[model samples]
Target: MSNGNETAKGMGRRRGPMGGRGMTPGEKPKDLKGAIGKLASYIRHFKFAIVIVAVFAACSTVFSVIGPKILGKATTALSEGLMAKIRGTGGIDFTYIGKILLFVLGLYLLSALFSFVQGWIMTGVTQKICYQLRKEISEKINRMPMKYFESRTYGEVLSRITNDVDTLGQGLNQSITTIITSVATLIGVFIMMLSISPLMTLIALVILPVSAGLISFVVKKSQKYFKNQQEYLGHINGQVEEIYGGHLVIKAFNREQDTIEEFDATNQKLYESAWKSQFLSGMMQPIMMFVGNLGYAAVALSGGLLAIRGTITIGDIQAFIQYVKSFTQPIQQIAQVINQVQSMAAASERVFEFLNEEEEDQSVENPCDISKVTGAVSFEHVHFGYQPDQTIIHDFSVNVAPGQKIAIVGPTGAGKTTMVKLLMRFYDVNSGAICLDGHDVRSFNRRDLREAFGMVLQDTWLFQGTIMENIRYGRLDATDEEVIAAAKAAHADHFIRTLPGGYQMELNEDASNVSQGQKQLLTIARAILADNKILILDEATSSVDTRTEVAIQKAMDHLMKGRTSFVIAHRLSTIRDADMILVMKDGDIVEQGRHEELLKKQGFYANLYNSQFEETVA
Candidate 1:
């Protein structure tokens, strides 16, 4: 099968998802041995249990392997006794035949018992490994820098955590036992076949090259498509998630047909890769079986000739036939195990890539404590960029006194929210010092520094929980009464009281049950409850009506007392009473003053302020 990626590339379109960022297939790890070696470290903890499993697997396969040979003895004895009775020499040895039959039954039962125990042990080992992997991924996600998430799609990260890990665990569970059992059976069956007839053994050996060639050819042809299939699968999942999350936008914009076209393109690619992979990989078993039958024909013919020549008995020929059947069975199983291992290796590469991401530096060696911070903040000659080559914030500087309300107004992408991000230390400045109170912010622990500030963004976030619980998330120890007070202060208590279950009403996923404006109010209540010395409000009232905004502004006016607050807003009218206004454009502060002072200047801030009114006039 041809690689779909190469085909797509040949068509001049890059191999990726759809119109948006494509999730092309992950490259195979350059170091397969190293990747597998690291995976083994996770397995090493369960070595003792795995060793026990191996012992049982080996014993089970051995017992099963010996059964056919031992049963051949019974067949030979019965045949000899019958021949003797036919010659009128002696009656068949019925008691001896019964003893051999009972022995064979015992062997089969012992094999079954060992096989069952092996499976049970392996199940426990696989589950523990999966648990460890998931736990590590969860922790890794927390430690990862913001840049990592910004660069990768959320669905891609989630796929690593869920799909890749599951594949590794499930593949190991099935492949490990099959590998041990198949190898042991192959070895034992080979020895038994040799004992039965050397000629038959040689005939069976002829099938090995043919089977190997077929499997190798199919695997080589299909491996690339399998990799493509995995990538497209992730792309499909990512597209579906994006569409689902922004379905309202799609409908509003009449992008339903465009979305379907993009999805169909991705789906078409997925289908091409999937069918080709399945078709080629699936051809293995049937082809192997056909070759095995040819070997079987050859073996039977040789065994019959030997039997007629009195070189091998009919019972021995029968055992050799059974051995031949058992031999080919393990070869097929081994082929399957190899495929599973390759897939596991692919999955492990993704998991290891996540595990190996550069985590945020969280050292607290020279940490400064800000438990009693007074909310004075300063940005000293900050220089930074999201990308190294493209600087966004250039030599920006600002200082705010305690209990001051500063409003940041700017055009979109004019570095408005970026200032808040810098203050919160989400992304550190390339060269500068940000200080809280009198101490450098970097000197303070990230957790402690963030604890001093309360942020309410335009995009409200409420998890699936009761209204009370979502509010309480701000200050976990807050009493129910305290929560109600905070809600009242944010002008949300009246609405909450009217709900069917009041604070107990469950918020569904995405909190779609509540209006966007209501969600913003809850977030404001959360900020109020946090009671931090520093507050950052980013378009906090953008979603609410004029009446609601007035009420929210009144509540916020009370909340802002005795606290240093930074308000980022597009509506300059709301920030009229701010102690100071910093008008920014292209990552620089072009004008700064109180609203009245800036309006008199008639600069960039004036144009920005006047444009809103002009748009309204139009």
Candidate 2:
């Protein structure tokens, strides 16, 4: 739950309103071309669909662009007929005007139909791409090395799957159609305006640079504010999640006022940046409109002069003005599309980065069969470190015959649990080998190697399911009676039955409804149900009360019979009856012997045991 803050922050960084208009500008891809190239490769299979969408978009824009010119014909006829009637030479042509109006309406309906088809196809393509990316990312997570997860926050990884992929999807859906339609509209509208009057078309062309300059200026001014807003939003999100998760701790320490102050500070910054960005972005439309009006006024003035001189018809002037308005709109749409492309590139890069991370080798060339392994384990000069340059377990060596109860006793940071991890191959040793039944652990497939052993750690893990289901997780094919038998063996059956629904009782996520001791007991039952040839218990009894611990120790002794068991215990009293006690310090075993003999030697183990005895006496 402590990781909730990191997840919130990651989400906030990429969070924005849909359609790419208000996306945060905080992140940009380092290699824009490369990211786009990779994204292009992903959609190459859908190229045919994209081509269809582009054709539809062009058709839609072309029909829309031709509407004004066709409409102008009707206007010309009506005006000429009215003038003729005033001079008593002719009358209005309502029939011709009606035909022109109906034709224009058909064009518009076709345009809308084309637009819908393109939009629908583009949406399907975008969703498919997003789905594929998410699927690959999910598969990648399982194959990724543990070190990668340990080095980064879970939220950061999750954001690549959720936020980054979603941003990429939305950007693709909007940007592709937008770029196609906007460009088509620009070309078609320009051609229409030129046909009406090159002089008015030229006058409209001058407005492009002015409108572009204003848009550029606004984008430049608003970008920094957008970045600040995104940064502060992430900060606020992280702070809120962190404080909420630990509110009880804050309350216990009487730090509510401090938390409030911190939250206020972040909220204030978010408000400041958010308003500034919104204000600047909001100014763009009005600014463009102002520049557009200047162009419109100039065109209208020029068209009227040409009209009076009979250089162009009144209908031409009307159509040219409409074309001029249509022309500036595509330019604005193109500018927004550019922003969307940039955002898309940034998001795709993040998702690709995660997808390309190094994956663990989950298989071997010819895996050894461990099904019949008798668990004769040995570590021969094994060496390892989470980081290669800083070795933790140095020159470790040990051997255990089948069916030995081996207790590992040490202070914290003495590589006790590390030894168990090595045996299980959670991490492979940097040098030498850990072997079972004279075969190196690496010789077997990771799954086969792991299936031979069962583990019960100090931290019990139970998912959101019924108690019966959680216990059944140990051996998925086990029967309900076998599950109950295992639970009885671990002494968990009594408390489980006392619960509201007994075996059917559901545990919430984290299993907070149960006491710490109960959770530990449930895990023990799970391990017992697994009934592997090798068992590793790392402080498995540390959570239980004194009497429960005694009962559990007896259960453990019974379960460990005729199996290779490695027990790591901080409480020296718990492992006194073990067949062998190996005392470790600073990643090396300092001593090893039966408990009584080790105490008689008056060495490190004896001193540790004496300290606990003194504490008990006091």
Candidate 3:
């Protein structure tokens, strides 16, 4: 079946558990409670800010309740008493009316002050949580194995760290406070209304449940759209990130039109889904308000009649009308806040999924602390693979003494690099053992074992920094003089000196400011300065020009001395003079000998060498 058919089938299956399978959402979904709990746990880290915001919210609610009650009471004073006529209560009683107005004015001032505090507290909480989650995500990625990265895109990972986390921030901080404050305001208004007239309150609440039920029904339908919107947005973010990073590749392959069409398709779907969700959610407030006001009118009409029949005073009826307005205001607020809850639940699931991933095994429980390592390597029946249950290396064994140079020769996918990866502890062996100086590699600490080798790869990634800083990356504490010396040793200084500011020269994104050859040599300089006892060059010169290859090879000769060096070769020219060469096939060493011995055997290595030697002559 096609991918689209598979995706449709999967989405259909997903709805069964998400309350999307003909299920009513009378309460929060079971999964949602856990998501809410996780968000609350993360939110509790900023308890001081939460407390400050809660206090401000409480002050605002108190002012709201008092301000309304006083205004109503001052209105009733005029109709109920001779004090209403003698003091002409409604018209400026600068002494008494002024006091009432002044008290209301004071409440407004306090409300404004607390509102500003609430805003600041909420902003701080969002920023702090976002910062903490971003930091945790970064650390988590570092711990994950290469397998996780291999199956995922740079774009997808980027979307999770950026877009998804931002969505979570909106939910965790601002959304939590919005829902809490709105609910609190609703409860406060309800109590005030009940105190005024239980009958009138009952009349106002009669249609409220129906309005809530309809608003909830609309939200339930739109929740699926919200999920779709978020999923498609992640896809869109991934696609856009890909296009921007690979603009040159798209332009080179004449794929611009196809790429643009793809982007438009993604963008349009997101636009439509977002529009549908927002439009549906937007309709909720107005419909609920309309129903609430209908109840409000009923309270006013019926209460006014009770006052005329002398069953209740005009003051009590007037107070009841004002209380009805307060009660309805909070219902409108509650309907609006429900969206925040739904959005956070979706984001929390993603964030937690990432955090819960199994990290790479770093279990060297009894780690040997090495003061100095004199590179001695032995592969005793060594076996390895990048994945579980898939053995790449079978009965592979070799011995390299200190100061020996070894070259590994193989085709593209013959596990040459995989062997190198194993040696570096980027992966552990499937079976057998790799040892250094008669100690199992696993017996030593990970950093110490890795620190024994300085490695250079085919593709060099230069961070956003200066020339000196990039070179200093190998040993962060290395001085400027040492950085320049390493650059000189690797033949990188000549080109670097030509650039503006020499050592201080800045590298743009991915070191695009410099040529590939320059970047490679700078990486070599980084490895050289570290001065490790072992060296690994994994097709390091394969991607560079002949001249650059010559530059790196010359540097390799100097560094390889007195160190066990493993160079995985693509060009046969470099391995002819090596002390030993191991020809690999399907993760096994098919042949191993000196260059002359391998050439006379006319085995796999001989054919590869002859083909390359012939190509050189031709």
Candidate 4:
């Protein structure tokens, strides 16, 4: 199949993130600009390190020029001075020769030392850049909206953070400096070659322009392949994430071979692109060398003719050959740098795209710093939908006084959870307002507004840490005594005590080490521990066994006594004690009253109650 990106429009207003249900496929981000400038800004953070590397590189290049000059002088002196001594007159000027040889050796040593220094410094710079970039990317990921994650796979993002960024490190550390220094070194060598014998320089360089043309052509071709290769790698990574996350389903369906085939297709695409890129890029060195060797032969032949005719000395011809030998290697190095930049340019674009994601709107101004907000919530003709074209809640309204227990019961997709999301400002209403304590929630800082309420979602999220740490996450500054107290209050401390380490038991990745019931209890503990004036729960007790569910109901009773709680659950029997039950269909409340009062009304809530009542009798 063709790439989705290839077909995506550029900079289209389709504003949905990857993951879950997102917006319609809008304009693609290829319109994202200045990937090179973004990457360069990252390098700029290490200016001192760059300066040191560049300075050393310049010094090494300058020192490199002395090699051909010193060798030529020594050759000239040896040939003439030795002949003079052979004719037996002057003392042979052996002292001057010794000093010149010593200086040449010193220059070589200095060049070697500077090379080492530059490498050492650049390594440090690259590592730090990696650290900072990763840190910044992680922060951006946290702040991005849920919709953004809905549009792409986790592995694609991971590839950008890990593989893509590492590829750019080579360029930042050494390749750029190497190219700059090599250019300087090459120019110096070229001038010297010309001064020795301009006629031979002209002959040797006949093939140089052709070699350059071939390298440039290959670089242009390789760049496109490199970009395609990186994108293919991202697709492959996304496939891997999907396969692994759904490994159980694939196994149950006995589709291992099918999975392997799918994987192979993406893998092969990556391989083909990368292989083509490497093949073309690899040819650069050999082809340039072939032409360089031809240049060398031409120079050698022309210089010999001049030497024999006494038009130029043997020493000049000897030095010219050395310069010619050195020229091609630096030229090849430059070609490699160009190839490298293409790959890094693509990677930097992806990484920066992630960095520039629009964070969830936290644009509301900070409000009064009151310690406790009275739980008064009102949905005043609020309208909302994940997508604008499809309205989920239209002109809906609800109001709850402080400390009221409101249970929302509805058919699936009736905007139950969407209500909780809007109150938390995970999203804003398309029209109208959700108010808390007589103020629109959007008027307060999102963090402070969220602090007014607590949530226990259907899928509880526990980080890789101890149970104590996870609970402490509810209130970062909570004391140990308080954490244990909240755990006991949520009826989770009983299980915590049974574990080997009690509250200190470490949660494995995604909390897979714990039972589902235990996970739910911990999440409930978190909501209780939060001590918020407003509480929101979705399928809060769906994981608990009947007996534990009863126990949790008791725990929630104490926590719910003095807070405005909005509970969304499929289990209608669980919310029988709520002060009011609102039955919803589509996006409107069809029935609203106390549980018994709604049952007396024989509306949607009563019908839902009767359905569960029949399931029980069966």
**Best of the candidates, lDDT:** 1
Most accurate candidate by TM-score: 1
Candidate 2: worst-modelled 10 consecutive residues by lDDT: 14-23
Ten-residue stretch with the least lDDT total in model 1: 1-10
lDDT of the structure predicted as candidate 3: 0.75
| Of 1 and 3, the candidate ranking higher by TM-score | 1
Q: Please, what are the lDDT tens digits per residue for candidate 2 over residues 408-523?
A: 99889999977876786667899989999999999888777878888777766787999999888888899999999999998889999999999999999769999888887887
Find the number of clashing residue pairs for candidate 3.
0
Tens digit of per-residue lDDT, candidate 3, span 40-147 = 887888888888888888777777766776766666655555455567663434466567778888988887788778977898888887888789889887677655
Query: Could you tell me every candidate's TM-score relative to the true structure?
Result: 0.92, 0.86, 0.88, 0.89
Q: Is candidate 1 or candidate 4 better by lDDT?
A: 1
Candidate 2 clash pair list: none
Total backbone clashes of candidate 1, pairs 3 or more residues apart or in separate chains: 1
* Two-way TM-score contest, 2 vs 3, winner: 3
Candidate 1 Cα errors over 4 Å, as ranges: 1-28, 90-95, 613-618
Off by over 4 Å in 2: 1-28, 209-291
* Candidate 4 TM-score, true structure as reference: 0.89
Give candidate 4 misplaced runs (Cα > 4 Å): 1-33, 72-102, 366-372
